[model samples]
Target: MATAPEDGMKHPRTTNERLIDATLDAWQFGGGATISVRSLCASTNIQVSSLYHHFGSLEQLLVSAQEHAIDAAEAWCTRQIGLLADDAMPPAALGALLAGLIDDWCHDERRLAFAWRECHLNAVKQATFIPLAGRWTKLWSGFWAELCERLGIAGHAITTARFFAGESGFHLVPWNRQIDRAALGETCTGWSAWLCGQVSPPSPWRDRARALAGAGLVLPPLRDDVAERIAATAGAIVERSGVAGLTYRAVAVDAGLTLGVVSHKFRTGADLLAAAFDALYRRAATRTADELADLPAMQPEAVSHELAEMVVGEFAGSLGLDELLLACARNPALRPFGGHLRYLRGRTSGHYLAALLGPAKPTHHIDAAIFSSFLIGVTGVYCFVQDREERIAGAEAEIARVIAALTGG
Candidate 1:
């Protein structure tokens, strides 16, 4: 019988709670999807029997960790919203607070940012997590909507909030050394101005991003037939379960090939990851080329409709590019692929501007990056909302705002 601690002292977590905490720690900081029951038990110094007795199964423990992570995320967001809701907070102070909030999520060791992202991915993979993820989306979107209304940016409140959400997602890419505190602070300050209806807010980071974009990484394309099949299968696993779920055996089974076949081609797990990432990059590149050629000639409404559909796919987790790129953050061997993708996504995103802002507008990689963030944000809003018309309308609204903000229309 353990007693609760006295005031100011930390209460000792129960055995069940400790196991759950360890699962979350692994998810947040380790290869969560691949973590074995034996590893978990060893880390917790708890017997394997205790784990089964406490949670019944490892899958159950993972679900419990997801729930715990969501609860903690909501609590933190509520506290931040409370602070931001102060009517008397000055613009400078508000900007600082907003920047601080972004920094708190992205720059620190809290790993809440990563946890939140994993939750989004898990929501896509696990049907059961949808309702919980939907609840979170509703709560946060509503909070941002209310804040936007209060700040007088109510017209595109939900989409605007989604942009911030997307921006945070961008920062979570571990290889993005460009997203420092100063950059986030300035970005938040610009956002503060935009919230107040000031178009063309100070964006010093744009020039820096553009300059950095010129520094590109080289990734060789995958050309072998057998290797391509293995890589594609592994990439599917990555999208479905995440990089943690990618194993040679899993890929071999899924690809209808033997383990030795996969091992002979890729040599190691890292080799498999590299090939898969290369395939994803090449696939994205081909799609980008097609979009550039087609999107510019299409009617704005048609383009909007097409993009809205993509957002729908994004919500379903069909787009595994994000998972692939973010995995590089943890794997040094795969950093080149991730770095190349940063440039590729920026270039790919330009098609949106070419379609909407016109090819003559002279957009840069930074503009495309900005557009990507807003679009990613819009995808989140579109995910939980079921009405197709409403989703399209939301997409259009965000597009219009992006055009106006970028063009200063």
Candidate 2:
């Protein structure tokens, strides 16, 4: 790992330190994705009153945790940059420095999973997501500008740099507890170095997919017509419902197509979502293959974290059928319907990680009992907010504790 950046100095641990640290994990794992308050309480090991005293209402706490985590992350990255003397900042040094900084976040499962769920309040006009992520985007962009200038290729730097970061990003909301960060980091480092060398300026997206051509994509390979309609439906749901309003009926109506078509093409809504989501996810996953394919025997650990972010983002965006998918299970009259939506979400998620590690068989299913409880709990906390930002911080700290207990993490 490279030397720590001066800005990386952690803030003085607070009275709410546990929640503060967990806030980073929640945002990374959940990303403005909703969960429950009971779940949050269980996760944090704090009573509702105690939480309220320190962070105010649930909503305010979410906002606070988010500010804390992002501020810390920003400081960490700045510290990494500060470590290098002006003359000593070589291209390789820059890469190594960034890698080390990223490693600090990526290798630590707790830190890597926060922003994904906490900031979800920013979704749609309804919104979710860390209010502070704009800072992350801006900071990362700045770093990209610097990196690209050092490499003498600022033209495509933003996309290139985002893609580079994407390689290690997870993008999922309320992250899968399945990933092993240490293993994932190894993959990113080895791949990051190889990718930097291969592409003149380095592109970490489809370019990498073209070379190795592993599984290419992960869906069942639908007919063009069916695929188009499916995509149209799925995209519409995301645009319309934030993440929970998607339904088979909604898909049929939006496509101006019949239920028969949806049913015939998709054995069940879950099946349809699984296939479409997987296809989309695979395209994204192709990044590892594209960006790091040339690396002799890629490592999964390095990019696993980034893939997790991508997965979270894709999942957050997909709103197939409420009954089909289960970001974390809950009871609905149409439970299968929710699973269908989530299947699509989860399958797509797998694609991002597939390039580094062959897509693992689905092992991320959550309990309907706890899942439902968590959603209600988190959403309830979020809904009561006077300040959306405040709600988000509370949500992160609260959910982190739940996840910690659930995963025994």
Candidate 3:
């Protein structure tokens, strides 16, 4: 169980501190995404009166816990950046630094990252969380901007910030096999240096990473179209309230079908969720196809602008896509379907890159994945943060610049 940090010698924890610590512990390890007063009290051995007295309510306590988490993350990042600046590391070191940061977040401190994202999803679903989410988006964006400036890569700061955010989400998916951490680190280092205007040597593992690509998002055909309708209904619920909201009764009621029939078709909540994942991916795949068809005729600048718009629009307009992808990762039965999204995310971006970089220039799957992930990060930040329109415009400009850099245009 997590507890409040000790300054020197350990002092006895106050009731408020104990409550907050319990919440953080549950968030990090105990699968406590949705905590209640009862659960917190039960775990901490504190009475309900104490919780109400210190935090007023469970909602306030959760908020306080999130605030503490974000603050800790910020402090850690600041320390890392300070060390980098003090060492006067060259631009080439940026990638290694980035790799190190992400490595820590994904490995040693993975539970914190997981909890952070879970909280973010909740923030998106509930209006009450908007303030915290927006503040977090801003603080992190500023941190990225500062790091870029310090590293002499100020020009690509916004785009890099957005890309890192997306990469954070992309790496969150629990893959069947262990991730190639060294290859991933080297690839990121080379790319980071290249982006910062260095002539980076091609990573040996580039092809191997690219080989992880999937055959794009292809769903198995349903025996009857009604199953598709049922999936769509379940997907809509996921969009509104996440996977927890997806139930047979809810889907049946929403789709105007009988519970017996819905249950008969899907059999289990996991089955329905799997079907919904297919449905959501199908929708995204259709959009990717439709968007790619026009890229051939569009100018490179127009293609860059459109790519940014499309990615942001897709994520901002619907919450189900991210939720379903995460759900697929968590559920064993849905892992196979989830794996495709891991590699194929860049299909649309790859096409857009092809239009910009031309048929001759190699637009690798890995590049597409990076670009698409950045777009995802951009969308994630833009959706919750303040100055929405301004940020979008700035992000589009940075996206174009990144496209130019990555494609050697």
Candidate 4:
């Protein structure tokens, strides 16, 4: 007979619990989309049979991992809310609460990992995980709605919650890079306080704009080369600091150009973002084509592996593609540009299929769409892993799996 662990559950229950815990831990670290059952088993010291017996399928296991993480986050938030003893939380209490949330989000590795995974899953629109994702959104929104009501903060509660959720991922970026945590926390607290209407101040950027306008500093028109440099600078900003950080002033500072020059060239923030994404996509396409050209002619039986290698190489070398895609996915101003990039990628995939298969079937077009989506999901997952070699190996394996499925290999 199988022996039970010290926790007192029966052997099977213990095994299932271990598998669930291991799956959550691995999924949080490896990202929910890229983690395979084999990896999970290796990490957990459990067998594939045990995983199947518990979760039935990889998709179910991922769903379970998401459910487990969401439940844990909700429980933590509920406990934090319990700290507010009265019906109405005062400004001080709200500030403290927001600060505590920021601390948890920044200092806790598990929370940070899961938050990034949730953002990626949401961006990719993975249908299997939508219900769980919706639950998380509802939980946070409900908490914010109640807090806003108590604090008499008159605004769209759900929108405010969603905005904070988006900002949470943004917050994690600096945390991941071991940037100044103290400064990040302070900024988060200040932003939260301002959002709750607890603080009101004149816009610093507006004041700067006025200062610039009052100076009567007429700038020359942007030359073509300077305009391209500005666009490339914007791409780097989006890659490094995310879409929220891509301000005209920031671009101007980075490009060594005056703010007037950047503004004159791009006109609006949307125009600037479009230009940035255009540069990013063109660079990615060019890099991918270059790498694919280096690969030998594909054999039908080995084409999947060749394509997988090409994808891994492209992603490994491309500096901004991952961040650019995620930032564009979340920014409404960038959606049309993102859509155009997706169409281009799908067309590119179809071209590769035609090259390899001699003729593209109707199914090839659909496969190309699926292939594009798979690349997005895998790339998102790849960004969160801490180990570079492990990330590259996982990318190759995952891409191979995707290609095999698409090509019926």
Per-prediction TM-score: 0.78, 0.44, 0.82, 0.46
Q: Rank the candidates by TM-score, best first.
A: 3, 1, 4, 2
Per-residue lDDT tens digits for candidate 3, residues 36-132, read: 7998999999999989988898888988888877887787777777766454446666777777777677666665565576667777666777777
In model 4, how large is the Cα lDDT of residue 310? 47
Which one is best on TM-score?
A: 3
Native-referenced Cα lDDT, model 3:
0.68
Q: Superposing all C-alpha atoms, what RMSD in Å does each candidate have to the true structure?
A: 4.4, 16.1, 4.3, 20.0
- CA lDDT, every prediction? 0.65, 0.43, 0.68, 0.54
Clashing pairs in 3: 163-374, 166-377
Q: Which whole-number lDDT from 0 to 100 does residue 41 have in model 1?
A: 91
TM-score of 2: 0.44
- Name the regions of candidate 2 deviating beyond 4 angstroms: 1-15, 82-86, 89-105, 109-131, 141-167, 170-218, 221-270, 278-409
Ordered by lDDT, highest first, the candidates read 3, 1, 4, 2
**Pairs clashing in candidate 4?**
none
Which residue runs of candidate 4 sit more than 4 Å off their true CA positions?
1-13, 91-96, 109-116, 119-125, 154-156, 174-179, 189-409
The 10-residue segment with the lowest total lDDT in model 2? 361-370
lDDT of 4 by residue, 59-99 (tens): 78767666767777777677766776667655434444654
Residue-wise lDDT of candidate 1 within 1-409, one digit each (tens)? Answer: 5555667587767878888778766756664564678988998899999999988988788778767777777777777677665564444354566567666776663566666666666665566667766766776687676666665556545655676787676555545565445555665565555445442255566445434543644343555888889877877787766787888989999999999998998876667877766665555444556556888888876776676665553343335666865576556666556545444465656676667766555555545655676677777556656677787777776776655654556
Q: Lowest-scoring 10 consecutive residues by lDDT in candidate 3?
A: 209-218
Query: Which portions of model 1 show Cα errors greater than 4 Å?
Result: 1-9, 35-38, 56-60, 82-98, 176-179, 182-216, 224-227, 245-271, 282-291, 314-319, 331-334, 341-344, 359-362, 381-409
